[model samples]
Target: MCVWILIGLCIITKVHGYSDGDFPQSCDSLLPEHRRSGVNILPQNTKPPYKVTYKPGNNGEPITVSLESNPGHKFSGFMLEARETQRVDEGPPVGRFISLQPDTRLLTCSLSADSAVSNRYSAGKTLIRVNWTAEGAELDITFRATFVESYAKFWERVDRKVTIQTTTPPPTTQPSTAEPSTAKPSTANPSTVKPSTAKPSTAELSTTNSSPVTTSISSSTTQNTQRPDALGLKREGTVQMSLDILFVGVKMELPNIITITITNSLFSRGLIKVSNILCSLLSMAVEISAPILFCANDSCTVTLIALMCVVIVINFMDLVIVSLPIGPSHELKDICDLAAKVCSVIHMVFTIAALFVAVLEIDDCRNNRKDFWLLKVMTAFTVWICLFLIWTFVVSIHRNEILGRNKTGSSKWREQGKKNKLSAAEVIVTAVSVILIMGTLSFTVTVIAGIFLAKQTCA
Candidate 1:
């Protein structure tokens, strides 16, 4: 039973960690059949079984060729050559002779210049040759090739294909024209045509007299002037559509919005959503951490709750500030922005402290199952809160430039500001932003370390 259990465990480990379930068994799968058929050469096995791996490289990277031999058999040394199959350009043969280390089971080498391979990856193939001495026999492998394509080249091809696909309109069928009417004209029309000598009806006379006035009015139609914001609306629509397409993948959970009304709505709802999530995490953390932390020092729990309340208030303030309209002067906007920046700093400080405290509490949590799980939950919440905080900080930094500023206007004030060294306030804001980012990072690291330490202690 123990033997079978050990065997099962080995099988599970191999399947989960080491086995390549669906990967190609050989280098033959690297290129299309036509490309592989003519170039692939089966290496001679004069001594024992071995495997060869071919890896095509990308820009600024080298092509890797490796050989692995069975135990008690290995290649002593090898010569390799690689050249582009289609010789539109002439260059030095990309080949080298590599000596294997003594008793080494595996030997690998890079062929061709990394720069050259990068430059000629698209529609390029490197014909390779290998010759080696093993088991007192010299064996050679010739003409094996791998297709090469840099990631940049691959994306370029994709873009070209996408452009072509988008631009090519679907096949359209012309509406068939009806055959020309062939019925002859009425027989009596030409000879029996009569000219009426009657006086015109009153309505017809009135319409004729009124027709000139109507015609004059119609001919003198005024063109409606475009609204001042019409062009702005068109540009906004275009930009919004572009963003919607770009973020369609991730928009389900975290949506991107650009329009004024929609952006305001998103922020209002997002603030609530973020606050609820944070509150849930805080409650979980408090519950899990109470035994380890609150029991020893109840002040820490009160401090955490109080910090959470302050954070909630700050978030509420942010939502309010964001919801506010831009007043006649930019002063109100700047003030709101400044408030948000300050709030971010305060939030960062508390968040970092909370994470640190939670992690510290986990030192006592190793023996208690409840304590262990709760600490983990708290750590997770702290990480999430830190992530949201960082995002808020970044958004605050770029909010004015992206969403509030006039794109086309020239600002002498900004030019002068740039000419002058940054003001004390600007310097302070910059310093705080940097500090906030660093604190968030440190807090995240603390949470991760706390989790690691707890796991190690449990183990």
Candidate 2:
């Protein structure tokens, strides 16, 4: 902290105010040429509190320009000048201020003397009145100013566009459609300048113009990858997907819940130690991989959120293993198992559908191919899910065949005709069937919804 204070003080010592109307460096941007870090151009706030009050002047007539701020707002310094309306963004202000207040003086720009008018002292003042004489050559002209509330704060490009009528008026062939003589930069944006101070939302206290966070509204959107102009853009949907990883814990797999209940329920389960562990590991790895996109940036929140989600899923899986009953007499468990499996089907169907929509939404751009590896990942996961359905069915059939052939060695309860529990094959079949049906429905709903949203957005 002490070191930082010293650094700030050292920089401050060299940062003298541009008091003597010596800010020709700000000719283009209209911002004070401090060029130090931590200052920036913010977006418009509310309506501008300053206004321009003027009357149309004919050729050779000296025009009065009044610059006033709203009550309670005083600017310590300002630079005011007029430019041709056609070159508003680029033209230079030249010798327009013929008479100026003693507190304000004329600025000799790079090419022209008395090219602009500015406050001569760094004292807070509310109003500046000056006389501008048109040098016989006349067209439309506008008055713009950069007002400094203080050395450290100011608003640039506060302008009011008005038509200064030339002395020898041309034939008024058509009715003047020009707006009222009064002009404010833009009614839509106050000051028509970056304002609201927004000192708080400072592009991470931006020494530059960009202030968007990792998952900001701008970064989360997926843009057209096919545009050659987007070659340098971040991978498509990467930011949005990273944000989605935080929900993995809440989206715990349904099959894992059933697997935990099988050995302790009416379902006579087979060994699932291998496949069960592999499935959970695979899914968790996929969720974890999502954070790799964030590695390029310094946003630790993405990594932390992803890890937190992973922890939640692991805890839920553990809870399922620890809580279920150890016998086949869980009548409630039977009903719950069936219902949960049905819900699982519905969930997977939606999952599959969502994955498909994700694939469809991928930006088809050659340059973004490497960044868009997420699409390939979605396809691989889909294939694996389909394989899980087929593998479970095939294993269950094989298990049933083996069990039927060994009927002679069946449990005493089965031998005595008291068998009522569901077999491994039955359990597996129910789980697989529920998944297939629900997954299909999920896909259909996703595609239809995507289509509807696309139409709405395009329209």
Q: Estimate the TM-score of every prediction.
A: 0.24, 0.32
Model 2 TM-score on a 0 to 1 scale: 0.32
Per-residue lDDT over 217-272 for candidate 2, one digit per residue giving the tens place of the 0 to 100 score? 23223222222222111222232332222222123233433543354432423233
Flag regions of model 1 displaced more than 4 Å: 1-300, 327-331, 366-446
Q: Local distance difference test, per candidate?
A: 0.35, 0.49
Clashes of 2: 14
RMSD of 2: 23.7
- Model 1, residue 359: displacement in angstroms? 2.0
In model 1, the worst 10-residue window by lDDT is: 155-164
Task: Give the per-residue lDDT of model 1 (tens digit) for 1-459.
Answer: 999999999988875331211112222222222223456443332422434454322221222344444564433222223332342123333333221111111112222221111110112222222222221222222323222222211111000000001121222111111112211222335543221111223335545545645543442231012211212222222222222111211111122121222324446456534543443344334333333333233113444445445544554554455456554356575676467456545644554454444443333323233555545555565565555556555655774454333533323335566534444444444454455444534544444554555444433
Report the error of model 1 at residue 302, Å. Answer: 2.7
Residue 30's lDDT within candidate 2 is 63
Error (Å) of candidate 1 at residue 369 is 19
